[model samples]
Target: MDDTGLISRLGDVVGEANVLVAADAVAGYLVDWRGRYRGTALCVVRPATAAAVSAVVRLCAQAGVAMVPQGGNTSLCGAATPAAEGRSVVISLARLNRVRAIDAANNTITVEAGCLLQRVQEAAAAAGRLFPLSLAAEGSCQIGGNLSTNAGGVQVLRYGTARELTLGLEVVMPDGELWDGLRALRKDNTGYDLKQLFIGAEGTLGIITAAVLRLFPWPRAKATAWLAIAAPETALRALIALQDRFGPALTACELVSGVALGLVRKHIPGPHPTLVDSPWHLLVELSAGGDEASLREELASFLASMIDDRRVADAVLAQSGEQARRLWTLRESIGEAQRIEGPSIKHDVSLPISRLPEFIERADRALVEAFPGIRMVTFGHIGDGNLHYNQSRPTAGDQTLFLAAQPQVNRVVHDLVDELGGSISAEHGIGQLKRAELLRYRTPLEIGMMRAVKEALDPRGLMNPGKVL
Candidate 1:
């Protein structure tokens, strides 16, 4: 399509005010949140409604101009960012924010894709329920992006990922047809089950406009604890013990390496409330709709036994709700702390929970041997076997040279993960950054099947092209 002509057409479809073509105006949408990718877009279009999204998509498809669907623009893997060539038009779903319905009895809330993650949580809370997909980016990340990546957060141990929290979706297919599968049905044995296609497609197959998300009962009783563990394996053992005692009430169990905590203390401004000597820490939360005193007492008794057995080195249970949040702040600050430390090679990989400790030990040893003085920050939901295994700059090497070896470093970490029946990209989807790695790791047969599905839904390949499949 002619550049000027296409821009004019898009402006006509969504109005001039919604169509952004100026370089300064479109710059923010071009680059990714991590500043790792920069793509040029002929323009960026903002549509306020599902119908507008369908129309703009249809217009772009007919013009043969590639389009990118972006929400919140918080992707660490360049999923929401455009390519360096900037040949496509970035469509921002931020203006499509709307809450369609909320059924407390059915335990579902229908919302537009542009609504921020925190807004959804607040809406659920207002309805006397909870949307348990809590994450550090909850204040800024959007729901559409959450579903597109099948996001896993601190609460995934109990409530599951974005995939589990979702019931239905309203997507604009690549061909511009609206798929109205936004039903609140608990069980519908229909053929094909099409809604699953777009959930984690990263906007490759279609653009998610809205979703019907599942909600849970708000917990009345909650207990949070910070434990100093001897090792990762010990943390794993304590996890099993706590699960046996607390059962379903065990909501979150996160592993935090001392190295990561060190970064948090160094880069982030704080009093460093946690002792600097603990080798590893576990942030454990138990939530229920029962008596708070009973839950706290039970957890304290369990921890005392664990300490006696040498599973836990030392521990501190939150004495009040504010203290519990303070404990969680340390866990949540790791990402920001790393950001301040400078660009590093990161891998959000996951393995079988049974293989987690071994995977960590081996991967750390291998990376350290290959890249001496490389600071390895290993921490994540050990209960789920997902580790945000990241490697900081070596104390001696040139920063540019070290970053240039990301692909090789990724191979070392991902190879071990693959050998242990793990995924290279865990909660994060195969966005633009990992698209090539995904192709390298996935079998040809699997890639063929994914391509077939993508072609079946988006034959024109105009919706979020150059992403996942």
Candidate 2:
């Protein structure tokens, strides 16, 4: 059987309209949102249900064709994009967007793979619950992609990562077997946790069709503050103070660099807030069961204490929900601001909270010395130690030249991260971007163990080929 035969067979399983091969129709499926990865696909298949997905996978697997499971195509590392070979069939889960069920009593929601993250959040909110996995692309990113990458967003400090929130998953195995593991039980230690393997596997083992996600009680009140700190050390002190004072109510603690803020202010339109000029800033928030006024007063009191200690140089407290959103806009727009600024090497790295200050100082010193005039745009979820440590080309340097120096730049930053006990890729999975770097950082034995698991689950190596080991 050839590509035509497979396409026809897939059409038979799904409708012919769902099997898209036109240049315009499949264009978006071939490339990543960052435009860093571009690939060719024989066709893009849209399966509307788990059973249909199983049929499509069975046909493709029997035809010896590779399958790339894609959702939302919002991957920072090109995890959801097909390879340049163009021989694979991109199994898009977009048509599977649906809310399976919501069990408010059990604090769980079962959602299909293609359900937009924002949609899931809205559904939970409508049911008087909170689904806290939030990211800049939540409006466009899908639940399957979130689970596949084990996404960690701004609220990870309080709610946890996608893996921790996911209670069960429905996966279509590489060989076209359907594994219906969508059990919403909070505790079932029967044996090996199978759902976990597929959660962060980046679709190598199987295609996630649906998931049962954990939910929480909605916060009755919220207090948001934007604190201007002198440096990362000052930011750390503020984090400790906020955690000590508010405990779990301290939901988010984001660190943004002055340089990063400048880009957002310059490129992104704003009624942006006015604050004292500082080298670094911390976007802090506290949400708990109380009235808004009292929460704000408590947060204001804590800010006052910080001001006396000089840990916080200046602070701006949001008096309303609208103001809080504007503050969040500043922090969330860093990536897009960097995008509009220009192309450069990007690192989604994480370090121990205590080691972050040292890592930043050492890495900054080393990178500047080596790259001479490189621009750093850095910010991240301070509570979780994940930093979106990105770089831009020198003010007048050619983009091509700066991009070519990526490997050398990576060595400098990634080497230091390893030295300080950090991760090369944090929230972002080890997709095509970090495939080579994974071997460099991980031991051969560790890689072997991963390979063994992949082999056992997907012996033919057809599932999301050429990604994550």
Candidate 3:
């Protein structure tokens, strides 16, 4: 149970070189991606295989030491960071990076949890397939964390969230037992889908070692456009029309506020005059198994009709692939721009598509009334009803003062989210940042059932404590 013995046992399971005991080496594991949370860990452990991870977990469980499973440490909600108690070990799965198999015939990619999402996408592309789970952090975030958080990105409008993309999972349970459920089958209705339990559990019930993910045919032809809409209501109507015209070809339909675009233009360097000034913008993309020329023509015709009908004010279609990438870069840079600007209160919530307009209107009004002259930077996967609704300090105000109002700001935003039957934590998991909020929003019975399940799986609570339930 002593620290020395614990480190030695962990070293024996993995290797001495993989066990980071010094403070300087473990510093990165302590802090989160957003620099919002910093926690202490007894040590950082690198396990390169499922067997090694299982051994590490068994040792930690037997010693009554908690284990925080981490991958890339790219969590938005501090889900992968350790607590400040300095009693837990941070198990980094980055060493387990590997593509176990790529079955183009079965349309699945079996990969270790440590594989970066972009790498997986690349691997799929090399094999003439598409892995659609993508976000701004795709370059660094790993598949394990993506599944743990059930991440939703712009593509969720077509491909669904991480949970939907997952076909099977290989997990190391809390007690250090390996549950090799990595079956790539599409249908096996034997009983309860146990993998679902750990998908969005935030590593509390177990650690995901690998996964079998679904893949789609590579998009043959694509079209991207930026539409200047009147408001969120207009964006919704545009989405319906686009879907009706293109059906599943409509791959992504994102809503970006003018303020969000302004931040990108101000903070990030890029070409100017590419898009017309507008109150709200919708970045829409269509992917189809047809000729590129035909797809572009169809999208152009659709835009022209929308403009004539007054559904869209003005629109510009990407003339080339590079132009499309530039348009996407604008949508993806909002988060980084916000960070560069200053400290802000960020909320990742989802509402029914029908209620999104009302939710935005009410939340905006209430926030401005509560904190006069507050700036709202709202944008996200509108087609999927998930919004990254964030607030920044007024131009003349201090960030310290604005940050101090986070708790109050959260109440105003979350209360309205509840009334609208939306989730407080949509794509983001209930990590340390939202643990209390989860308790407040979830019903007593719901919380009790979650606790019961947690107790049944991790009775000692040695798994990632202080997260989720």
Q: Each model's C-alpha lDDT?
A: 0.88, 0.93, 0.93
Badly placed stretches (over 4 Å) of model 1 are: none
* Alpha carbon lDDT at 270, candidate 1: 74
- State in Å the error of residue 27, model 2: 0.9
Residue-wise C-alpha lDDT for candidate 1, range 1-469, written one tens digit per residue: 6878888887887899999988889989998878888888888999999998999888888888888999999898888887777468898999988888899999999999999999999999999999999888888899999999999999899988998888899999887899898988879888877888888889988899999999988899999999998788888898999899888999999999999998988887776565537888999999999999888988898899888988888889887898898888889999999988889888999998988899988988998898888988888998788889988997677889889989889999888888999999989788887888888889999999999998888787777777886
Cα-lDDT of candidate 1 = 0.88
Q: Write candidate 2's Cα lDDT for 212-242 as tens digits.
A: 9999999999999999899999888888878
How large an RMSD does model 1 have? 1.2
Pick by lDDT: 1 or 3, better one: 3
Query: What are the per-residue Cα lDDT tens digits for candidate 3 across 41-73?
Result: 888999999999999999998888999999989
Q: Give the per-residue Cα lDDT of candidate 2 at 104.
A: 97
Clashing pairs in 1: 39-83, 40-86
- Give lDDT: candidate 1, residue 135: 87
